[model samples]
Target chain A: MTATDTHRTIEAIFRIERARLIARLVRMVRDVGLAEELAQDAFLTALSEWPRTGVPANPGAWLTATAKRRAIDLLRRDRMLARKHAEIGRDLSEEDDAGIAAIEAAMDDDVGDELLGLIFTACHPILSPDARVALTLRLIGGLTTDEIARAYLTSEATIAQRIVRAKKTLGKAGLSFEVPRGRERQERLSSVLEAVYLIFNEGYAATSGANLTRPALCAEAQRLGRILAGLAPDEPEVFGLLSLMEIQASRLAARIGPDGMPIPLTEQNRARWDRLLIRRGLSALERAEALGGADGPYALQAALAACHARANRVEATDWRRIAGLYDALRRVMPSPVVDLNRAVAHCMAFGPDAGLALLEELERNDDLRNYALLPAARGDFLLRAGCSAEAKLQFERAAALSRNEQERAFLLGRAKACSV
Target chain B: MRVMVFVKATEDSEAGVMPTTELFEAMGRFNEELIKAGVLLSGDGLKPSSQGKRVAFDGPSRTVIDGPFAETRELVAGYWVWEVKDIAEAVEWVKRCPNPMFGPSEIEIRPFYEMADFGDVVTPEIAEQFDRLREKTPAR
Candidate 1:
C-alpha cells in the first residue's frame, strides 16, 4: 500500500481504538490525562512503524501492548526517583516477561467495565456542563479537540483548555475509575445521559447561530448515544435515550426547508424522513418497553416521537395517544417545556381553547418570559382556532424573541401570512 | 433493503469542472469493488443542476422552474442505488468511497421505503402492484 493509504488506515484504526485503549490505560495509571498521552504515544509509534512493517495483524493489541510498556516505564522511573525500594532492588531487568504480562493482563481486564468507568469519570458532576461535554466527547466519543471545537463553533484553544481542566478536576477529586453501583450508578448514569441529551438538543436547534441546525453535532450525539447503548445494553434508560435520539434525528432532514427556513412538524414532507433511523428507533423503543421502561422519562419521550414516526401523514398522527404520553411524562419529569408540549398536544387532540388555557397558565410563570417557543405554540393554536389576527401578533412576538435566524424568518413569514 | 446515496453538489461539480483522472480511476475501482461485493445496484453521475428542470404543482396547474437552482446545498451531483443489508453496512461502504469531486464532497445515505414500512396502510392489491413493478425493473 502507498504511504498516504497506510497513514489514512492508521488514522481510521486509531480513531476507533483510542477510547478503549485510553480507558484500559487509565485503569492501570489512575490518570485520565496520562493515559491519553500514552495512547497518543502508541499512535505516534504506529505512524512511524506501520508504513514500513505493514499494519499489525492485531493493531489494537499492538497499540495496547505499547501503551502498557510506557506505563511500566513511567512507574519504574517513579520508583527510582523515590529511592525507597533500594533494599528491594527497584531496578527490574528489562527482559522481565512476567512484569510485561502483568501490565498486559491489567490492560485487557474488563474492557466494558473500564469503558463505563471512563464515561462516568469524564461526565463526573465535579466538572461544569461545558467541561463535561468537552471531556465526554474527547474521551467517550473519540473526538479530537479541533473536532469538538468545530462542533461547538468555538476556538480550539478553548476546547483544549476545557478538556485539560476537566481531566485535572477529575484527578483532583480522586475519582475511582470504576462504575458506581445501585443508586449511585443510576444517578451517575442520569448525569451522563443528561450531558448526551444536552449535546443532542444543542445540535437539533443551535442556541444561537446563523443556521437553523448543526447536523454534524446531531450526528455526533446520536453516535454517542448508540455507543452508550452498546456499552450498557441491559440498561433500559440507555435504550430509551438512544431511541429518542434516533427518532428525533430522523426528522432533522425534513425539519429545514430548501430555503433554510424552519419547517414545522405538520408542514414537513414526511417522505423525506429517514426510515432507517426510524426503524432503528422503533426497535430501540421496543427494547426499552420490553425492559419495563415505558414510563421512564426518555422512554416516554421516545414514545412521543414514535407516534409521529408511525404515522404516514400529519393528519393521521395519533394526537390523543401523544397527549397521554405527555401527561405521563409530566408526572415523571415535570417541566414547563413538557407542559407547553402537552398543551400543544391537547390542542391537536381536543381544541385550541384547551391548549390556550394551559398556555395562559404557563405565562404566569416568570421563567418562560423569553422562551420563543411558548409564543410560537400559542400562535399555532390561535391560527388553528380561527383567530388569525391574534395569531399574527403572537407570531410577531415569537419572531422577536427567537435568536435563530431561520426560525425567526419562518415565524415572521407566518406573521406576514396572517389575514389582515 | 435499498439505500439511495446522494453525492452532494460541490463547487467543482456545480462549476462543471470534471473530476481528476486519479479520482475517476479511484471511483471506478470503488464501483468495481461494490459490484464484486454485490452491493451496488445502479449508479450514475449527473450534469450540473443548470441542465436540470423542476416541475412545481399549484392545484392542477404545472409550473416548470428552470435551474441552476440557487441553493447549492440542496442540489445533487450524482446518486447510487445500493442493495445493502442495512444503514450501518451502507455507511461502512460509503466511508470507504474516494472523494467524488475534485475537492471535498458529501454523500448522504437514505433508505428507500419498502412496502413493509407502510404496514397495514399498503393493501394487498398495492403490494402486488409494487411486486409487479419490482419484477419489471432490472435485476440487481
Candidate 2:
C-alpha cells in the first residue's frame, strides 16, 4: 500500500481499537492518563514507522506490543525500573523464542480485562460529568480533544482542561483501575451506560457541527455498548442501553434527507432503516426484559424505541404503549424532557388537545424556559389543533432557540406552513 | 480503614454549575442508598478548581498552582472518605453509583492510610494535629 493508504489504514485501526488499546495500557500502568499517553505514543510511532516498515498483519497486537515496550522504556526513564522489573522481570529476560511466546501470552491475557477496567474507571462517578465525557471520548472513543470540542461545540482549551483535571483528580484520589463489583457495580453501571449513550447521542445529533450526524461517533458508541453488554450480560440495564443505542442507530440512514436536512422520525423512510440493527436491538431489549429490567430508565426508553420499530408506518406506531412507557419512566426518573416526549406520545395516542394540556403544564416549568423543544412541541400541538396563528409564533420562537441549522430550517418551514 | 472516593472535575463542574434538580435528587437518592448500605462515611462536591490551589514541593521551596490548572489529568475535583473493612469491600460499594455526569464525567476511588499503618513513627502530638486538621476540613 502507498504511504497515504497506510496512514488511512492506521488511523482506521486506531479508531477501531483505541479503547481496547488504552484499556490494556491503563491496566498495566494502573493510570488512565498515563495509559492514554502511552497509547498515543504508540500511534505516533506507527505514523512514523509504518510508512517505512509497512503495516503489520496484526496491527492491534502490534500497537499493543509497541505500547508495552514504550511503557517499559518510560518506567526505566522514570527510574522506577526495578519495581516493575521485579514483578515481571524473569518473563522479560528470556529473550529467545520462549520469551517471545511468554510475552505474547501475557499480553493477550492482560489486554481484555484491562480494557473493561478502563471503561469502568472512565465512567466512575468520582469524575465530573464533563470530565467523564471528555476522558471517555478521548481514551475510549479515540477522539482528540479538538475533535471532541468540535463534536460538543466547545473550545479546545476548555476540553483540554477538563481532561487534564479529570486525570489529575483520579490520580490525586489514587483511584484504582478495576471493574467495580457487587453493589458498587450496580451504581457505576448507570454512569458507564450513560457515557456510552452520550457518545452515541453526539454522533446521532452532532451537538454542534455542519453535519447533522457523525457516523463514526455513532459506530464507536454502538461498539462500546456491545462491549459493555458482553462484559455485564446479566445486567438488564446494560442490555437496555445496548438496545436503545442500536435501535436509534438503525434509523441513521433515514434521519437525513438527500439535501442533508434533518428528517423527523415521522417523515423518515422505514425501508431505509437497518434491519440487522433493529433485530439486534430487539434481541437486546428481550434480554433486558428477561432480566427484570422492564422498569429501568434505559429499558423504558428502549421499549419506546421498540414501539417505533414495531410500527409499519408512523400512523401505526403504538402511541398508547409509548405513552404508558413514558409514564412509567416518569414515575421512576421524572424529567422535563421525558414529560415533553410523553406529550408527543399523548398527542399521537389521544389528541392534540390532550398533548397541549400537558405542554401547558410544562410551559410554567422554569427548566423549560431555555429548552427549545418545549415551544417546538407546543407549536406542533397547536398546528395540529388548528390554531395556526399561535402555532406560527411558537415555531418562530423555537427556530430562534434551536442550535442545529437543519432543525432551525425545519422549524422555520413549519412556521411558514402555519402562516398559510 | 480510611478511604477516599475521588470525584474528578470537569468544565461544567469547575464552573460551579450545580447539577440540575433532577440530577441532584437522583444523586441524593443514591447517596441515601450508600448511607443505608453503611459504605458511606462522608461525601460532598467541591468548588471549581479555579477556587482552589495546589502547592507542589521542590526541595525546600513550594510552587503553587492556581485553579483551572493547565493539566487536566492532575486536578482534584472532590472526594469522600469512608471507613471500610478492606479495599475489596470498598470496591463493592463503588460499583453502585449512578452515572456521575448525566451528560459527560467520571469518578475515581482511592484508599487512604490509617494511623495504625503509620506505626510508632507518628507521635501522638502530630497525630492529634492531623486529626484536628481533618476534623476542620469538610468532605468533598
Candidate 3:
C-alpha cells in the first residue's frame, strides 16, 4: 500500500482499537486522562512504524500491547517520583515487580469487561450531561475533540474545555475502572443508556440546533449501543434499548418531508420505513422477550413502536395491543409522557370519548400543562368526536405552545382544518 | 441512512432456478451477518417474472401488463432494506455478500434521502441555541 493508504488504514484500525487500549490503560493508570494520553502515545508510535512495517497481522493487539507498555512505563516513572505514585500506587505498593505483575494480569483480563467499565466510567452520574456526552464520544467513540465540536456545531475550544474538565471531574471523583455490581450496576447502566439515547436524539432531532437531525450522531449512538450490547450480551435492557433505537431510527427517513417538515407516523408513507431496521428491531424485541425483558421500560416502548411497525397501514395497526402496552408501560414507568401516550392509544383503540376522559385527567396534571402534544392530542380526539370548535381552540393552543417551526406550522394547519 | 439493495436477476433466476444447497447456505450465513450487525432490516427473494404482473398508469387510464417482463437482467430477483452509517458501509457489506446466482450477479445500493439531502436547510443558528441551552442546564 502507498504511504497515504497505509496512513488511512492505520487511522481506521486505531479508531476501532483505541478504546480497548485506553480501557485497558485506565485499569492500570487509574486515571482516564492519563490512560488517554498513553493510548495516543501508542497511536503516534503506530503512525511512525506501520508505514515502513506495512502493518501488523493483528494491529489491535499490537497497538494495545504498545499502550500497555506505555502505561507500565509511566507507572514505574511515577513510582520513582513517589509524589505521583502516592495516588495510583496506593492500591498497590512500592514493590515495582509485584505491581507490574498485577497490572499485566489485569491487562490480560477479559477485554469485554474492561470496555464495559470504560463506558460506565465515561457516563457515570457524577459527570454533567454535557461532560458525559463529550467524554463518551471521546473515550467510548474514539472521536477527537475537534470532531465532537464539529458534530455538535460548537467551538473546538469549548469541546476541548469540556473534555479537560470532564477528565478532571472523573479524576476528582476517583471512580473505579471496574464495572459496578448489583444495584450500582443497574443504576450505572441506565445512566450509560440515557447518555447514549441523549446523543441519539440530539443527532436525530437536533433539539436546539438549526439542523433537524445529524444522521452521523444517530449512527454513532447506534454504534455505541451495538458495542454496549455486544459487551454485555446478558443484559436484556441493553438489547431492549438497542431494539428501541433500531426501530425508531428506521423511521428517520419517512418521519420527515422533503420540505423539511416533521411528518407524523400516521401520515407517513410506510413504504419508506427501512425494512431491515424494523426486522432487526423485531428480532431484538424477541431477544428482549426471550430474556424476560418484555416488561423492560425500553422493551415496552419498543413493543409499542413495533405495533406501528408491524402494520402495513395505520388503519391496520393493532391499537388495542398498543393501548395494552401503554397500560403496562404506565404501570411500571409512570410518567406524564406515558399517560399522554396512553390517551392517544385509547383514542385510536376505543373512541374519542374514552380518550377525552383520559385527557380530562391529564389536563389537571401540572406536569403536562405546557406540553404541546397534550393539547394537540386533545384536539385530535375532539375533532374526531365532532366537536370541531373545541378542537380548533385546542389546536390553536397547541400551535402556540409548540416551539418547533415545522410542528407549529403543522399544528396551525390542523387548527385551520378544524375550522372547516 | 437507509438503503435499498437490489440483487439483479440473472439468467438462472429468470428461469425460476433455485440456489444450490451450498450457495443457499453461504447466502444464509451472509444474511445472518447482516442481521446481527443490525444492518439488514428486511429482505426476500422474488419469484421469476413469469409469476408477476404490472399495472401501468397514464393520466386517467391504466393498463394491466402481464409477465414475463423483458430485460431479465434488469429485473430484481431479491432486495434488502438496510440501515447503515453511510453508503460506503453499505458498499462494504454488499461486497461481502455471496453471489446470489449460480453464476455472476449484480447488487445495487440506493440510499434513502434524509432531510439533509434536501437543500442546506440545517442552520448554524439552532446549534448556537443548543450551546446556550447546554451552558444553562447542569448535568441531568
State which candidate has the highest DockQ: 3
For candidate 2, give the lDDT: 0.76
lDDT tens digits, residues A63-153, model 3?
A: 8888878777877777668766356537445587788898889889877789889999999999888999999999987778887888888
Kindly list the per-residue Cα lDDT of model 1 for residues A290-340, writing each as its tens digit. Answer: 998899999999999999888866788899999899999999999998999
DockQ of 2: 0.01
Query: What is the C-alpha local distance difference test score of each model?
Result: 0.82, 0.76, 0.82
Give DockQ per model, in order: 0.03, 0.01, 0.05
C-alpha positional error of residue A289 in candidate 3 after TM-score superposition, expressed in Å:
1.4
Better of 2 and 3 by DockQ: 3
CAPRI classification of candidate 1: incorrect
**Residue-by-residue lDDT tens digits, candidate 2, A1-420:** 777667766776676557778877766676778888888899999999989988786777789989988876665555445556566545544334453454345467655466677888888898876688888878776678888887777889999999998988888887768778899888888888878888888788853335533666777677677766665668999889889988998787678765676678888867656555687788889999999999999999999998887775677789889889988999998888889999999998899999999988998988679788889998998988889999999999999999989789989999999988
TM-score of the first chain in candidate 2 relative to the native first chain:
0.76
Candidate rank order under TM-score: 3, 1, 2
Residue A47, candidate 2: how far off, in angstroms?
A: 5.7
Minimum summed lDDT over a 10-residue window in model 2 chain B is located at B131-140
Tell me how far the alpha carbon of residue A420 in candidate 3 is from the true structure, in angstroms, after superposition. Answer: 3.4
